[model samples]
Target: MRLEGKVALISGGAHGVEGEMMGFGGASARLFVQEGAKVVLGDIAVEDGEKTASQLRDAGYDALFVKLDVTNEQDWENAVRTAVTNFGRLDIMVNNAGTGGPGNVEETTEDIWDGQMDVHAKGVFLGTKHAIPEMRKVGGGSIINISSIYGLVGSVGSTAYHAAKGAIRIFSKSAAVQYASENIRVNSVHPGFITTPLTREGLKNPEREQFMLDRIPMGRIGDPDEIAKGIVYLASDESSYMTGSELVIDGGMTAQ
Candidate 1:
């Protein structure tokens, strides 16, 4: 009941580390719904997104699915419109849609770099821009930007991904400072290597998985639910005094 009576919009909810049972966005959305929050689940994967929404609806939770290409401004507008029209207001905006960009600087192409930037950095910019006015009307709200542990440190073979995530970290902080007076709290959540479809290929190789685990002080990859819990905290009033901050849920990866 942490988010009781709130309204949430979660992007990239179709699938990821949380699995069919629990994608990060999907898990967070479900958690919010269970806590009495109406959720707008958005993603480029229309089929999966719709399914997730239907499941929530079947459970008697208020939920809706919207096909969202985060890079498109019109998509953002339509998403906000749908949420406002259906739910009356938007209380939380989670910019969770992102991609793992090309892994090495030398191997990265211009297209890869641009695509990563468009989805991660530019997408967050657009989501916040459109969500802010609506949040203002409600007097205040929360914005959770999903970043990565790579944002805080250099990762081999993930130049563009690291750069985009790093940008989101600072961008969220700046937005938080600028909007604090308006009662809008902005924060970034940085997660370490989590067991998701995106990282499954690497995880399949025991050596690679062990390499990742060895770096984490906790000796494990984080669970999507763990990250979802952090998202809920930021989305709810529990984080009222927190803004312009980065919450790292990396299993102590960044600590080492």
Candidate 2:
């Protein structure tokens, strides 16, 4: 019960459905509830989000679903309100919503760049912005922004993705410095090639899967549950003195 009595709002929580593949948010929601926290799953995928929340409820956990477009301020407001209204208060905010940006600089267009920024950069900004006030109400809270290994290290492609995720990394540091006095901890999580719905399609190609495996020092892809455990540590009091740090769980991909 590391997160006992706490409440969390996770964007992109509908990345998977019941009895199907799961993403970081969905896995985090399950682990959080199991650790004794009430959870609110927020996403643009209404059906998947509702099914996930319902699945949790059926399993006897406290959970809810909200229609949230992370790029929209009104939606952020509504999601935050839903958390406070239903669960009483918000203690954690996981900015986990994202879209893939696969082109290089020359191939990347205005739309791709802007879209990447809107979801990865702007979305994290709004989530942190709104979560701060609510966190202030509770004396303090944890804000976990989901970044990528691409954020820390550059790749051959994904120019816009690297830019957006890099922004999140520095943005988290700035937020941590600004809010440290208030006890509101802000941090970022960077994941490697993981087995999620988003990556499954890409990894289906034998060569692509081999390419990823070859890069990882662990010689294997990561599981959502592994990343979820890290999130749990950050959300719980176990990391009480930690803030403005980057928790990288990439099977040692970045260490090289």
Candidate 3:
């Protein structure tokens, strides 16, 4: 009940390593709903998004699904409009829609690089740009931007993804500082090597799994629920005093 009486909007609610049941956004949305919050689920995957919303609604929770491609400005506007029109206010904005593309400096293509930036970096910018006004109207709210350990440090074969995530980290900080007086708190959550649908293949290989585990002090991968709990903390009044901060949930990988 951490988010009781709150309203949340989660992008990328339909996909990821968690699949439909376990995706970070999906879990966060469901958790918020279960905690007595109305949630608006947005994603490009219309079928899955609608299904998630329908399931939540059937469970007697307040939920809505909007077809949203985070990279599109008009789509962002429409999604925000749906939230306000349906729920009357927006209390939380989770900019969780993102893409991770493969590439090292030499292996990366211009198209791949641009795609990564547009989805991860620019999408966050657009989500915040549109959500802020509604949040301001409601007095105050929280903005949670999903980043990666790659944002804090680089890895092999992650050139484009790293750059885009790094940009998100700084962008969230700057936004948080600029909007603190307005009562809108902005923060980034950097997750390290979680086992999600997007990352299932890499984790399936025993050798690769061990390699990743060895890098983490915890010696294991993280669960989507763990990350969702962090999001809940940031989205609720429990984190009222926090802003312009990077919450690292990396399983001690970055501690090294």
Candidate 4:
């Protein structure tokens, strides 16, 4: 029960995408629930979000589902309000909703670029903006921004995606510095190519999968649970002194 009595609101926390199951949000949601946090699963995917909350409830955890459009300020406000109304306070905020970017600078359209910024950059900003007050009400809290290894290192394609993630990475540090004295810890988690619906299409090609695997010194990608564990640590008192830190769980990809 590392997160016992904590209230968490996770963006893009629906349990499934297309036919694949669970991304970083869903995985972290489960871990939060297991560790005794009352969770609000926030996502635009209403059905799946409810399903996930229902499953957690069935397993005897305190959970709720909220319809959240991360790109919308009103939606973020509602989600935060709902979590506080029901759970009394918010302790953890996970900005884990995002899409994979596969386009280059020239190939990327304005819409594509805007979408990435809105969802990744703007979404995170909104989440942190709204979540801070609720966290302060509880005396202090933690915010986990989901970034990517691509955010740390420049890559070949997906210029917009990289840009948005890079935005999140730095944004987290800024928030951490701003709120450290208030006991509000803000940190970013950078995952290398994790197995999730977002990467399903790319991994479909065995060649591409192998090419990615070859680059990782560990000879494999990551799992959502692995990243979730790090989140749990940040959200818990175990990392009480840590703030403005970047947790990189990329199977040794970045070390090289």
What does the lDDT come to for candidate 2?
Answer: 0.95
Question: Which residue pairs show collisions in model 3?
Answer: 17-196, 17-197, 18-22
Off by over 4 Å in 4: 16-20
Pairs with steric clashes in candidate 4 = none
Where's the lowest-lDDT run of ten residues in candidate 1?
A: 14-23
The numbered model that scores best in TM-score is 2
Candidate 2 matches the true fold with a TM-score of: 0.99
Model 4 vs. true fold: TM: 0.97
Order of quality (lDDT): 2, 3, 4, 1
Where is model 3 poorest over a 10-residue stretch in terms of lDDT? 14-23
Clashes of 1: 3
lDDT of each: 0.89, 0.95, 0.90, 0.90
Per-residue lDDT over 1-256 for candidate 2, one digit per residue giving the tens place of the 0 to 100 score: 9999999999999964667999999999999999999999999999999999998999999999999999999999999999999999999999999989998899999999999999999999999999999999999999999999998999889999999999999999999999999999999999999999889899999998998999999999999999999999999989999999999999999999
Badly placed stretches (over 4 Å) of model 2 are none
**How accurate locally is residue 143 in candidate 3, as Cα lDDT from 0 to 100?**
99
The global Cα lDDT (0 to 1) of model 3 is 0.90
Could you say which candidate leads in lDDT?
2
Instruction: Write model 3 residue lDDT over 37-105, tens digit each, in one string.
Output: 999999988888888898888889899999999999999999999999999999899999876799789
For each candidate in turn, the TM-score is 0.97, 0.99, 0.97, 0.97
